[model samples]
Target: MFTLDDLVRLVRDELALPLPVNGAVPDFDHALNWRSVDLVRLVLAVEKHTGHRVPIAELYRRRNLRGVHDLYTATATAAGSADPGSGTRRTAAGSPAAAAGPLPGEGYEDLSLHGWFARSAARHPDALALRVAGQDLSYRALEQAVEHLAGRIAERPGGRPGRLGLLCSRTVSTYAGYLAGLRLGAAVVPLNPEFPPERNTATARAAAVDLLLCTAEDAELAERIGRETGIPHLVLPDTPGPGESADGESADAGRAPGSAPGPDDLAYIIFTSGSTGAPKGVPIKNRHVSAWLSHTVPYFEAGPGSRFSQTCDLSWDLSIWVLFVAWASGAALVVPEKAELLTPVAHINEDAITHWFSVPSSLSMARLLGELTPGALPTLRWSLFGGEPLTVDNARAWQEAAPGGVLSNVYGPTEVTCTCTTYPLPADPADWPDARLGSLPIGPVYPALEWVVIDERGRRSQEGELLVRGPQRFDGYLDPAHNTGRFARWSEDDWAPFEPGEELTDAHWYRTGDRVHTEPDGTLVYLGRVDNQVKIHGFRAEPGDIEAALRRHESVEEAVVVPCVTADGTTELAGFHLGPETDREQLLAFLEKQLPPYLVPRHLVRLPAFPMNFNGKVDRRKLSEEAFDLIARYG
Candidate 1:
């Protein structure tokens, strides 16, 4: 039904991108060089032309001339099946490239981000787009800012569909640079200011960053990264520096010539640690972001009057979703004060923020510390929690802190564009402490997405590894070897054959590493990670389960149970706790009563506060490292 030719024509016309209409495939090398944003737009156009949801990696893997044709043919064949692979890769003719099936979202489709932003800007140009430190930028002002920066960017050397690094705090100018980079068709690499110079340098070198943009406050870090990476650096401020004119424009706009990339161009790279030694960069295409925002806006019911907090740093993919998804819906983004970011009570209350998105740890700390309350923060309507599991106790406390708000547990790794599944909060809080958050019911598959659970042997199961496939799912890692190993072919077709009386809709699925089972009602319950299970003295145990149990105890404010290796090289269960009133002996007795002897923690240490990652999760790796040092110091 869907032909590659038709898809190409549709893409050429809709996004106004140049396409090879002669049926001859273009050079893969040249295509790969095209900006990630342009490639994504091209994929979105193909999705629109053919009723198929093209997976992100499928589109990205089309590196050169030969790959594109195979990709198109394969996707075209699988368009209407239960599963659909994008036409970026192909198997030999008559051999299925992926499980054959219709792509997800064969019927309903949401708008693109470009369409939504354009509409919002036209309709509510005067409305607030971002609020930071008591200062606000209206939609009109934001548009002007981006356009002004985009114009200047187009005149620069590395601004045209190349790598541009942005180092700044959570401020409007940082957001502006991001937009400016997008407008110029360059991939935006957001650097973490907190990162040591070495990590920053490593990231810059790995990503092949060519430009660095930093705010005045982060000048030192920016200078360090630039010096190490040899990338040209520019400081932010509307005003130009010495020997420059008042306008922040590059002088040679008229003399320089280059191509202006389209929506399929590369937008940004969100890097995450892979099983591989080096950090793996996930190239996010403009179309991937566009497709995500198109669907994300309506699903969350965001609007001009809505206000969502800026909780995540740009380095984290979560921030991309938090910032743009809300903006696409005309929601005002509120960046709390530097001090308030951890708690964010004053900012939320003062700004009347309607939507709050954070990991469980943030909510827990805020509620436990009495920094947030339901009666005081009545304006809050929705709380979206993700990154890690939301324990029942934390959920109940969060609910009490915002009685009118509903909690949605979102689940996804950086590989998948921020979130692929979400489950709404339960209506009644009756099951509070008893709730075993094994598989957080991370709602149904979003439009154009597919999910599967696999057992230890890779067989499909009601409960197993949570594998995902969707348009939003990212392609393989930046490292080719890592990409090949972790992201591999499941089957020749998009959708696997479904046997009658089976609970899951058979499809080609990506293994999510997490183990989970599906309820009869199709809700997914999360089990712990496959690696989370450990054998102690030939006895199988789950540290997460014990930790969950401990968290339910009234005296234990927070608990982390991890296997620690003692000086004798024997593995022992160790737990670090955060609670002043909770006594170790009493808590240990309570745990002993419920858990087996081996599962009970052999060592318990108290901490005034838990060290957390940016997402607010107790940094288990850090905790483990500290455990080693503590033992060495005290022994």
Candidate 2:
């Protein structure tokens, strides 16, 4: 019933654009012909007509208006809902409803993270919930901390449901502070204290944050940032003792400042490496988080007595899984020191940890250190690897060491909640999923996700751009400009006439930027990303962001950052510069003042001039290839 003219009028009305008296209208490739606002107007117009709103994030997904039309048509014909096409993903065979064992079937009055924690803590008040560096905090104790911190936060001049920066260490206060922000329904933006003050302050400014919650270690840093940015802060003790009272001076010293954001409200903002010379913050809503939790909680099969490893930085997205998944499963979360991660077998065996999740790089490090010899970790039962590609070799080696454990390759970007795909390795080595691409297959998408691959020519292909859509998908970027070109439509153009990847009837999907292939059984194979974004020791690093920081130095004239793989199979950012005279250590220290430790290039190569391509652009490929050799010579 929707006609082309009807779409045109809607677009004109929504965008407040003048309609041509000559009756000119946008064609199918309107995005190609229109400016940014025009495309936005068109999207709004389409949504108005369809009686639904598609996220601007669809621009980063499959960006076909035709596909949007079909999706709305199909969805509209069915039972209509407020968020049209929001619940379009297909549920997997053994979904939550069918889950058995210690994992209960889906039935929860409060699905919010705050709600879940409150209920869980009340039910088993004395259960060991969290431990950091051998210090234990039972559920009841953590709840009291949450209560004390939330009340303190609420009393601040600027109060709830906005961005609250958390500067904390791996301590009880860190866990308690994170929970307290959630209790007030605020979006918690974690600022790693080790990150250069410049980086933290810049990110805080970009998010327009007003207040911060910091632990004792980061108090001075928080104070400096507050003075520098006019954002007040509260200082929580390094540890919230189990029986601390309201009169406890340490608990009340949080003299500075702090939501109840809703179920669908933003829970947190995580910034990833960006190509545009700054980090891009992905605001994940509570529902986006719940969608992931509801699906994965049962899959892990963890119970109250189970122990979960907290080896990663809380800033890492996997830390999201470690925080909620462990507590939600009624398991004790064991936070690790940096050294604990290097020798994980000891951490696992010593603590009797039952559930472990980390990047394969850390596992490789464990093997390199001779800490992961065969049968080294018999207590581990489930090992989940993510953030970077998990090599088949690493998986097999880890499997051999923890013979009683199962290895699963979890794949996703921070943009799509935490993870969207999980591939559990077969018990038999030969029966394991394909790793011909130098990594274990990403396996099947999460039951709640639907994905497709778009080739370079804009057609469907067995290998190309991996895009996904589901309830777990994020709404859009904090900066809408990042949303553009992240999506394409499902259609055949003159360049390619065949269907690409898996065919979706009609829906907008999120382009993962990572290249992949889909197998006959719907399993996905990880190829590589189509951009410069790379994983550095489990953290997503963008060369542009690092390069931008390098340029910020007074002596630096120009800078280029390239991701280089070390001999050990881990990736590191390598910066090449053509700037004023500066030694590597000096430059590194300079960088240490403006970037996160991970973002700081492992190697800095100064060049008299950059190698140029025919197009007059820097030949980044050349720099990447010579990074190691250059580092050796320079060092």
Instruction: Give me the runs in candidate 2 sitting further than 4 Å from their true place.
Output: 1-101, 108-110, 241-261, 274-277, 489-507, 532-635
Residues 53-119 of candidate 2: C-alpha lDDT, one tens digit per residue:
4433344233444544554565556636545544432222221111113456656443677766766
| Runs in model 1 lying further than 4 Å from the true structure | 1-116, 158-161, 238-263, 273-278, 431-434, 437-440, 491-508, 628-635
Backbone atom clashes (below 3 Å) for every candidate: 45, 15
Residue 519, model 1, lDDT: 73
Give Cα-based local distance difference scores for all models: 0.64, 0.69
Model 1: number of clashes? 45
| lDDT tens digits by residue: candidate 1, 42-159 | 5555555554544444456554434555665566666545444333322222211111111123332343333445456777898788777567888777766666555555556544
